[model samples]
Target: TLQPDVFGLVEAARILCEDGFAVFPYTTDDLIVAERLLAAGCKVLMPWCAPIGSALGPINIMALRSMRGYFPGVPLIVDA
Candidate 1:
């Protein structure tokens, strides 16, 4: 399903929010996923700059900057 993966993340975020904990969603530069996480009450975001263990680290600097622009002062970690 086109929405299954997002649904799972949202559900998990909801559960974490319900438990009174902030969520740190790690998006693979997916705006939809990031938006869903935000809607699910995630306070911080950790978007990946590159695939895990890839020689390339942070392939998209603009994307990272854009993500940070969404929420200034919010801790947006760039996980490689």
Candidate 2:
């Protein structure tokens, strides 16, 4: 599994791994990290929407497409 946020995600992944889960945290705000996650057999999970009450749409189509290219079977959910 992969998380967008860095702070809490690392801890969550670490704990999950300790609990025998095959967890991997993708924290770096870099596309290379996404590819690495895929190479390491992680499913990408990104929030392609604004936070809470915000109204913005998908701001990174290229990045999204790149992720899709790497993990087409991995589910993509828009938290709108």
Best-fitting candidate, scored by TM-score: 1
Clashing pairs in 2: none
In the range 7-79, model 2's lDDT, one tens digit per residue, is: 4565565566557676545344345654554444445545344444456665566766776676678665545
Q: Which residue ranges in model 1 land beyond 4 Å of their true spot?
A: 1-6
Query: Model 1 TM-score?
Result: 0.77
Reference-based TM-score of each model:
0.77, 0.50
Once fitted onto the true fold, the runs of candidate 2 whose alpha carbons sit more than 4 angstroms away are: 1-4, 17-44
lDDT of 1 at 62: 89
Q: For candidate 1, lDDT tens digit of each residue in 1-80? A: 22225667788988999899987876666767787787788988778888766768769888887777776866777787
What lDDT would candidate 1 get against the real structure? 0.75
User: How much lDDT does each candidate structure score?
Assistant: 0.75, 0.54
**Among all windows of ten consecutive residues in candidate 2, which has the lowest summed lDDT?**
44-53
Which residue pairs clash within candidate 1?
none
